[model samples]
Target: MHPAHPLLAVTHPDPYPYYAALAREQPLYWDKTLGLWVASHPTAISAVMRHPAARVRPLTEPVPRGLCPGPAGELFSRFVRMNDSRLHTRIKTLLMAYLQAQSQQACTPQWPAITLLSAVQADRFLYAAPVHAQAAFLGLPDQLHADCAVQIQAYLTALPANANADLIAAGHTAALTLQDRLESHLLAAEASPALRQLRDDGARDGIPAALLAANLAGLLFQSCEAGAGLLGNALILAGRRSLDASTTPAAARTVIDHVVRHDPPLHNTRRFMGNAIEIQGQRIEAGQTVLLVLAAAAMIEPDNAWTFGAHGHACPGQTLARSHAADALLHLLHAGTDAHALASHFRYRPLLNARVPQFDFSKDHQP
Candidate 1:
């Protein structure tokens, strides 16, 4: 254990403060216990994330065999989690096509409806509205949305420390169940125009039904987790500013983008070193893992935070994600919510990876 490593603790909410110190003192700091190098500086992080020698592979080797056992193990083994370079690029290309299609059709149409629903259900159900809307966009039935949310939450709950063995088992079980449900839906959607077009366009395409299903479930799970965080953060910032109800959609987008840069959906992304390489005057051996703390890097040089990467790895979906958030905020502003009240309800998720808040609509809103 690196005595200075903040991640050693089970409940470290934000790792930025520690990361900043690391970047200043030990930009190439390595933790033996974790068997990974943590980079905090913008240049260092960007170099590591885009480094040619840095292989994007799963943590399959030296695996915590006990952590994920049985079916969860098998699922992880079979999924795209372990892919890299050629395979990763190929899969990502296919997935992008699918995502692009969905974004243009389903996502665009559903945003307004989702915003309306979120506002209507604000006082009564708060968080459930967006989760349900996510499920709806994925073509899931209304009844299954709550079940899906429960399953996702169960899985997340089992991830933190102090999680029980039984809880882990239950989370794995729910995940598998959700996977099965998603598979059935994907098969049904195969005949749909959008998906059919995707199927027809790609030749070497064999997007396993299981993969599509898992991806959909993963997207929703991620969206709810991260979207909620971003929304919460934005509300808090907007409230602090006492932003006018007449705030333009474009300005709201600027606020959301700033929030994402300051506190991204994921705190860091892990990559394995494929070969010996020198980064910031330190040589990292092959098979060594490197963790790029994006959230920390975002704050290092706030002015240049928007660039995802000098290389193409910058988030391709940034534009879309920004648009979606902007639209949602515009909807809230247009609905006549008071800026200060909206901000007051902002409370972020106490997770390390993402800095998202939980908005208490019931407490913040007025009739």
Candidate 2:
């Protein structure tokens, strides 16, 4: 059975064929069911991404309504991923340079201590290990990596519009903790040269330490669901290939690369119009949302990292993300995780954009 729409395809057992057709045929069109314009082909997706009037966040609501008037809202708004301002360009350039430099540095990631690598614990590991790796990569102390993962989870839980008061409040607390920790780390005398360079560049450019620190936290935030999907899908591929505890990181990287080209993590991302625009002769009104089906674009151009997005809003952490997933995959296989069993029985989580597998039987079932 095929998914009814691109949105539903995230959890669908097989969506690539459908995505291929969307790129080849539909390209761009209105979906009354979703109340948005869908752009699947590379041409249409590129048109939307290149538009000056296309914004990452909605013009009327820069931050989610529920998160307004709070620390979480402030931190969320500061992230380069969520904006379309000059600040975005400056921070993005600085951060990209920082990541490139930092990738050359050596640091150890603290994998979560799972007493037993059951299906459920593997599910938990999917989210935790990536944050741990990313936090460590950012030059945060080893002891702080696990805590940073916990706080990132809390911050993520509070992002949805329907989050309860408790989650929202915890998110605020987590935001404060993350911001404080990253800021202090950034200012530490023993900070890495890459981090020091980042701080100095920010100061020279008039960017605040708080904003830079929030973006450091944003690096962890970026690693969560999409990272999970990458690692999870790679694990499935390893299992299918009978790669076990003996699989080296290099071998695991081979699987991860295959996943990137095939069962990639993110399926789509969105763009909000600051003004009305026309793409391929179809008019999208001001404030309207356009769904950019990156997976479909990948079907058209398998060589590109379409899942991370493109243009000004594209993710800056693609290389780091793949390396972390490879490391985490190798670690999980060696930890006695039954990759074959996991590969045999799992369901995709109900996410709108990412296709992360959940092994716990209690949650969403296989599509």
TM-score of each candidate structure, all chains considered together: 0.72, 0.98
Lowest-scoring 10 consecutive residues by lDDT in candidate 2?
358-367
lDDT leader: 2
Backbone-clash count (model 1): 5
**Candidate 1, 195: how far from true, in Å?**
1.9
For candidate 2, write residues 1-367 as lDDT tens digits. 7689999999999899999988999999999999999999999999999999999999999999889889999999999999988899999999999999898899889888887688888888999999999998987878888898889999999998989999999999999999999899999999999999999999999999999999998999999889999999999999899888898878989999999999999999999999998888889999899999999999999999899898888889998899999999999888777789899998888889999999996854321
Error of 1 at 147 (Å): 3.7
Alpha carbon RMSD to native, model 2:
1.8
Of candidate 1, the 10-residue stretch with the lowest lDDT total is 108-117
Please provide, for model 1 over 1-367, each residue's C-alpha lDDT reduced to its tens digit, 9 standing for 90 to 100: 3325534321244545665566667666787866788876777877887777775563345223533775444444443433443445655566567667765655432332233324334332223434555666566766687777667766555555466888778767877877888768766745455556545544346656666667556655555555555555666667777776789887899888877765555566667887888888888888888877665565567665532433434544455555555666666667666657655544444455555554443454321
Candidate 1 RMSD to the correct structure? 5.9
Residue 76, candidate 2: alpha-carbon lDDT: 96
